[model samples]
Target: MNVVEVKGTELEDAFQIRREVFVEEQGVPLQDEFDGYDESGAAARHILVYYEDQPAATGRLRWLGDTAKLERICVRAAMRKFGLGSVVVKSLEKIAQEEGFCKAKIHAQTQAQNFYERLGYRQTSEEFMEDGISHIVMERTI
Candidate 1:
């Protein structure tokens, strides 16, 4: 698998991956999934992973002040359990740090808390519901 930084036309693939996982699979209302952040977020960085020349996973980083929030992380269902998700996160974290972010945070789904923990992210709050799904805030200092 290979990870690549994407922008402009290349970002369509990453957006589609998020739409498939968050909107279509998880039912996270389409309107809420795609928002105003796309056009003006100078800190936004998208990372896409490909396997055998096919897009297999994707994620994005949105910087807020000194912190970079990693969001919409997802691997194509058929590509799960293959470490593609980890690759996507690690690559994003590297990019975040290189960009001078002091920390990285993510709102991890409750079911995936352990996964994030294994990746060095620690839960910073009790579980909460967002758009009907349980989630918790996790963070890792860069």
Candidate 2:
């Protein structure tokens, strides 16, 4: 798997991946899935993972003060269990640190809490519903 940071026109493919996983696959409302953040946020970093020349996974990073939030992480359904999710998180962490953020945060879907835990994220709050799915805030200090 290869992780690359891309923006502008290069982000189209990543947006498509997010639509597939967050909108189509998960039934999340399309309006909630793609937001204004994609256009106005200067600190937004988009990561795309390619396997054998095909896009395999996608994620986004948004710098908020001293912290960075990893959001909209998704792996193609057929690529689940192949470690692409972990790879995406690790890549985001590296990018955050490189950009001077000392901490990283994510609103992880409840079902994937254990996955984030294994990646060093600690649950920081009670589970809450977001986009009709249960999620919890998790954070990791780099």
Candidate 3:
């Protein structure tokens, strides 16, 4: 497994994984699944994870004041069994730390609350609807 910072043509690999997992599988609207944060000049870093040279997962990290917001994290259905989701989160956390961020946050889908908890994140807000799915804010020190 390998994770790399990507942009330009290589960034398309990350978008493809997101479309497969978020837009196609999760029913998230195409318009909501993407936004200005994905642009090349946006204040965000995107990462693509590869398993045996195939893109398996992707995530985005955006700095918001003192916190690093981890977003759009998803793994291809076929790659879910390999624990790539944790890898994606940890990689993003590492990047945040490297960038001088001391805190990290995620708006986690309720279905994955336990997953984030297992990685040391604690729920910081009540469940709320986001993109029509129940989600809660989670935070942890990076």
Candidate 4:
């Protein structure tokens, strides 16, 4: 498995992975799963994790002013055992740090809070619902 920065057509693979996991599987609406950020000129940085040349996971980070917001993280269900989610987070964080971002945050689904906690993220907000799913805001210093 390998994780790397993606652009242009390569981002289609990222979107597909996200759609499979978030929209089709998790029931998130298409309108919520996709936004204008995927457009050619968006400031978001997308990352794709491929195993055997097939996209297995994906994520993105974008500047919300000085903070890097990590979003859209998803790993193929079949590839979850490989710890690809952590790999994707670390990769995104590296990119954020390289870009001079000292802080990173994510609206983490409640079920995945422990995963982010293990990676040094701390919950910063009360649990809330986003798109009908329980979530909480988390942050970490990269």
Candidate 5:
């Protein structure tokens, strides 16, 4: 398995995975999925996880002051059992550290809160709704 950093048109695979997981599978609106920061050149880094050369997961990281905001993490439904989700998050944290970020944070869906916790993220806020799904903020020092 390998996680790759992408930019410009190279982001298509990452976007495709996100659309598959967050939009079609989870019912998150398409508009809410691609939130425009990618086009803004905000220095956000996008990553794609490939398993046996097949794109199976994706995520992105953007600097938020002193912390790195981790978002859009998703593993293809068929690929979830292979531990690609952890691969994506670990890869993102590596990128964050490479970019001088010492902390990482996320707005994780309630159902996946435990998964994030296992990855060392601690809940930082009460449950909240985003795109009609319950979520909570989590953070960890990377």
Candidate 6:
């Protein structure tokens, strides 16, 4: 498996992975699944993970002041057991730290809270609704 920074037309692969996991599988609205931040020239840095040359996971990094916001993290269901999710998060964290950010945050789905916790993120907020799903804010210093 390998992670690559993708932009322009290359972003299509990332979007496909997100659509499969977040839209088709999770029921997120098409409009909500995509946003202006995905467009070219946006400040966000998108990452794609490929296993055997096939896209397996994707996420993006955006800055919120001094904090790195990790968003759209999703792994292909079949690839979940391969730890691609962790690879995506670690890659984003590494990118954020290299860019001078000391903190990173994610709005983690309630069901996946434990996964993030295992990675050293601690919950900082009560459960809340985001895009019609239960989620909570998690933070970690990278």
Q: Per-residue lDDT for 1-142 in model 3, tens only?
A: 9999998778899999999988999899999999998988788999999999999999999989999999999999988999999999999999999999999999999999999999999999999999889999999998
Each candidate's lDDT (Cα)? Answer: 0.87, 0.90, 0.95, 0.93, 0.91, 0.96
Give the candidate order by descending lDDT: 6, 3, 4, 5, 2, 1
Where is model 4 poorest over a 10-residue stretch in terms of lDDT? 1-10
TM-score of 5: 0.96
- Residue 52 Cα positional deviation in candidate 5, in Å, after optimal superposition: 1.0
Candidate 5 on 1-142: residue-level lDDT in tens?
8778888888888889889998999999998888777763657888898999998999988889999999999999999999999999999999999989999999999999999999999999999999999999999999
- The worst-scoring run of ten residues by lDDT in candidate 2 lies at 35-44
Better of 1 and 3 by TM-score: 3
Which structure among the candidates has the greatest lDDT?
6
> For model 6, how does the per-residue alpha-carbon lDDT over 1-142 read when each residue is reduced to its tens digit?
8899999999999999999999999999999999999999999999999999899999999999999999999999999999999999999999999999999999999999999999999999999998899999999999
- Candidate with better TM-score, 4 vs 5: 4
Residue lDDT tens for model 2, 1-142: 6789878888888888998999998899988998877874465888999977889899999888888999999999988878999999999999988988889999999999999999999999999999999999999998
What's each prediction's TM-score?
Answer: 0.93, 0.95, 0.98, 0.97, 0.96, 0.99
Taking every candidate in turn, the Cα RMSD to the unseen true structure, in Å, is 1.4, 1.2, 0.6, 0.8, 1.1, 0.5
> lDDT by residue for model 4 over 25-101, one digit each (tens)?
99999999888888777989999999877899999999998899999999999999989999999999999999999
Best by TM-score: 6
The global Cα lDDT (0 to 1) of model 5 is 0.91
Per-residue lDDT of 4 in model 2:
93
Which residue runs does candidate 1 get wrong by more than 4 Å? 40-42
**Could you tell me which 10 consecutive residues in candidate 5 have the lowest summed lDDT?**
35-44
Error of 2 at 118 (Å): 0.4
